[model samples]
Target: MAERCPYPFPRPTALGIPERLTGIHDEPLVPVVLPSGDEAVLLTRYQDVRQVLTDDRLSRNLDRPDAARISRHNSMFQDPRINPDPPEHTRVRNLVASAFSAARVQRLEPRIHAETDELLDAMERSGGPVDLNEALAFPLPVRVICSLLGVPDEDVALFRHWTSAFLSVSHFPREEIRAAMTEMSRYIAEHISHRRAHPGDDLVSAMIRAHDDEGRLSEYELQWWCRLLLLVGYETTATQLGGGVAMLLSHPEQLRLLRADPALLPNAIEELLRWKLVGSSVSMLRYATDDIELEDCVIKKGTSIIPAADCANQDPDRFFDPRTFDITRSDNPHLTFSLGPHFCIGASLARAELRIATQALLTRFPNLRLAVPAEELKRQEGALLEGFTEIPVTW
Candidate 1:
């Protein structure tokens, strides 16, 4: 489990996290001593991560050197997203909340279903051995977001490249990532200008109107939010879709069950999101603002703590049969999207996309099967947003 992660640490994967924390019921949290001579607190217990997320004592600022060292600055965990507390976080979250309300998302179901069918049609027309990730998984979120943002659908490839460069854990260098971010920002800024000149009923135009009318978000806020919406909103869902398909392929019986009864998809998607590993690795790097003591270690102020959400989700105290993947598992409380005040604001929209996606796909192509061996397949490693580079499948 630890060897899979190249970070020179003993962080466990989603599959191995449960077994890693066996018999540690006596302790609430465990201390991880990295090979780099750095110490971090690994919160394996579900309740513990929830407590810390809601706790006022812990800070989420990743720029602090003393904080746990993460590899990248994802928008979700960036300074703007993580540093603020209370009213500020509430303000930012609320401003974006209306953009993804339940009623608004509900209206898009038909269109999403249409898009899903079209993509599936293209895949089926291509015959067997099609890359599901390329065909269905990635395009769903990309097209949805593009439609919502009023961006030209043809530009998806460019933005996709930027999204890849933005959170990529490997291949691209630091300079390359910086350049990609700059180019993406410039493109978005131009789009903002264009939307300002020509107001439309899209998210960017709506935000522009909000800024003009209410004067809520500043330039940075608006730009950051736009970037956040496009990148986080798309990548997370896209990657999760890819990972979900991979999981279903790995468990053919579960896939069969899903095919037999499409009603089980909602809960099944939740379980998959809870169980699957997305992004490069699981380690929350938080700087200690004050001295704190856990079971075995005393972390001083300015020390970094790495809490493994993948591990915490499988805590025995919180989940029954932690290692087993049961879509119908009752009382399943996982921290895949995180918890507390800083919980994912796009939760509802994401779930809707997944539910609509999973159900539509399984119902459309019940014979969908993996075109390649699971172990032989490659996954995007060392990136903030973890997903497959490509998921090959056949119908």
Candidate 2:
């Protein structure tokens, strides 16, 4: 056995896929070392990635002494909030899915569109050479999430600070990351307390009802639900929205198809989700409970696994013409959201936001194009949840 390669498999740019991930065809499970100096195996094939995601034996309990520390500078993944067994996970997911998924998200659609339009209106006033990321991509999702999560929208700047620290792999010192987590926890805790005093129709209040009036979530689970929703709600969506714009702008043919049909927005969203390596946080740390047999090899007991969803999305076996971005491609079953039990609870919400953002841009600025070359766009190449820091665009 050769020495393990370094993990993360560095991408060339925010939108670029890593060369290493592309070259791991002969190996299904490759040994690697994480940023925290922990050993793990990478699963790049769609079959292996999905198998890990759906496997009940693979646990998310990083509290164990032997479990891999995913990042050295950040501890949010290690937070002792909700490391539930299967049953508890189901219960918590049920409560959250009710409040978060299709029905509630359907109601939130109008709000998403309105918020998207508001951002576009501001961008339109500026004319050209604006960072669409700063003006629209980041703000719209933050605003929508704040509205749904019942936090003050004016506190967006504070959240921008809080989330960056909370998700940092090595971006901040351990002390600063802890401080940000602590402050954000206090902020959410206070909001939960207030929601108890004066419950509203927002998600926090809904979870409060589930905890108090119903018996769905414990106090800890309820609070963590709010924190998770707030953390994931904006960042992932903002990343996808920004990347989606960059994708369409770079592929003028796809943009032309979208402009011509206008009905391809739904398919366009799926393609965008399938194509971009928008973030890396989806590949959560999972520990093997026992020796599990796989097509490639046996995953030994007590080993850490990372199902590289972005790489899996590009798997040629699952997706036809995976490299070429096609808006009309109908059979996109991408694992951008990890599959099965531990799947992203907010997948529906993310899809809705992506559709709304893209549609609004199509309607508002038909001539939207990148102000800088796609290669010139900047992001921390190996940041935990990588996204473009600036997606400068003009119309």
C-alpha local distance difference test of each model: 0.70, 0.80
Candidate 1 lDDT, 24-140, residue by residue in tens: 545555566532344565655566566677765677665555554444333335464344566666777787778788888888788788988899888778876888788888889
Clashes per prediction?
Answer: 4, 0
Report each candidate's C-alpha RMSD, comma-separated, in the order given.
Answer: 3.6, 1.7
Tens-digit lDDT track of model 2 for 1-395: 44798877776765676777665756777788988898888777888888877788888867778889878776645666667548768887877777676888999999988888888888888877899889888888888888887887666678988888877778888898889889999999999998899888888888898889988788888878788788767898888888888978888888898899989889989888887547653347788988878897788899888877777887888888787889999999888877788788888888888888888787888777898888887775435678888888987
Candidate 2 TM-score, true structure as reference: 0.95
lDDT of 2 at 63: 73
In model 1, the runs with Cα more than 4 Å from the true position are 1-27, 31-39, 72-83, 279-284, 291-300
Q: What is the Cα-based lDDT of residue 327 in candidate 2?
A: 93
For TM-score, the strongest prediction is 2
* Root-mean-square deviation of candidate 1: 3.6
**Per-model TM-score versus the true fold:** 0.88, 0.95
Worst 10 residues of 2 by lDDT: 275-284
